[model samples]
Target: MKERVLDLVFLIGVLFKGLDGLLELVGGAVLLFVTPGQVQRAAERVTARELAEDPHDLVANLVVHGAAHLHGRSVWFVAAYLLLHGLVKLAIVVALLVGTRRIYPWAMAALGAFLAFQLYELIVRPSVAVAVLTVLDAVIIWLTWREWRRGRELRTTWRQTVAWVFRRPQPREA
Candidate 1:
């Protein structure tokens, strides 16, 4: 029962990862076509009301500030990064969903690499959101490792049982 619950949690985590990947995929594609000026305009349009209401809204101000300083090169870099990251994540999630044993270790390794990169980013420039994401990614990787081992053991035991059941009978000497 505990294992079942853990499995459920793992599934939920994977689902969230897939959803996040989907969002990144869409955002990256959209960013490729949108100009920095357009992004700033949209940010101003969206945050105008909120900023006016609060006059000191942190989130709204941050969005406006970030959008204001966007450069064409920076935008392109970010878009490309997001596209690659999202595509890799989506592929891993699909393999995991389809129960591809061969990809489990590879997926975990890829995620671990991403986590290591995130850790380096944190060291260079810390952000609470990034920290949280890094932690979550670590947890997911650990869960995947555990589940893969469990599945491997189960498969080995199952194969042994099947072989024993199907073994040819020994010849009896009269």
Candidate 2:
């Protein structure tokens, strides 16, 4: 039951990351085809509705203000960032799900780096979503390490069992 729970945790992490990557990929592709003017107009409409619904929402206000300030180059940058980020995450998810022992350490390193960056950003910006994601990343890192150790132990035990099974019996005493 404990092993099953561990496997479930690992699988959940992989699925979450895979889904996030898919969203990023789809969003980036869609953004690439949208004109800056369209984005600005859509942002304005959404902002107006959000402000009308609740004028005191700081996040909505900030998003509206930022949207107003975006340029064509900013849109392009966003698209490129989403695409690259999605690709890398998807690759990591695949490697992890495939149980690539060599990639586990690197995956943990990558996640740690991202988590550190997110922590810094959370400190600077203080978003609830970023904070939640940072926590999730930390958990995933722990799960990955646990899974790796479990795999190593399983492999070692399997090797020992195989050796024991295949070993020839000692010859009769002289």
Candidate 3:
């Protein structure tokens, strides 16, 4: 029974990693074909806006509208975006494969689920993805605490070494 459960968990992790890879491909294509012109046009619009007293409004307006205008540029932006996007996806695939080899099974499972939750709206059901993110966030936080503790221990050791080296030696004579 335990073996079967472990197998199931491992299978789920592999499946989620595959799913994330697929989504990254699709997202990269979309971003490449759509982002440059939109980004350029948005930049132009921000420049066109009447000068405002508060910089916040200008910043907010650009953030809210720039991405909505993805059709503003030619194919060059698409080409560059897709190229960079592909490189990023390749790096992620390498990480996933490396992680599977080096990390514990449960940690691998958590990593896969975390990626799925983060990309939920893109790959899985949006509502379900949001729920997964909420639940997985607690797990991620706990994992982060372990990492933080390890870092603290290292820092303490480093501090001790520095203190020993830097402290003035006691005076031998009055």
**Top-lDDT candidate index:** 1
lDDT of prediction 3: 0.48
Candidate 3: which pairs clash? 32-78, 37-73, 38-69, 38-70
Residues 30-108, candidate 1, lDDT per residue (tens digit)?
Answer: 8899999999999999999999899799789878987898897989987897898898889888877665578779989
**Residue 9, candidate 1: C-alpha displacement in angstroms:** 1.6
TM-score result, candidate 1: 0.78
Q: What is the C-alpha lDDT of each candidate?
A: 0.81, 0.76, 0.48
For candidate 3, lDDT tens digit of each residue in 52-113? 54555645455545445455453445445545544544454455345433333344355455
TM-score of each: 0.78, 0.68, 0.31
Total clashing pairs in model 2: 0
Candidate 2 residues 1-174, lDDT tens each?
Answer: 565555556666767888998898887897899887776787778788778999988777777766676678988887887787777788888776554578888888888888888899898978777888899989989987886776653234334545655679999998
* Model 3: how far residue 165 lies from native, Å: 61
For model 1, the superposed segments whose C-alpha errors exceed 4 Å read 52-62, 152-174
Error of 3 at 172 (Å): 89
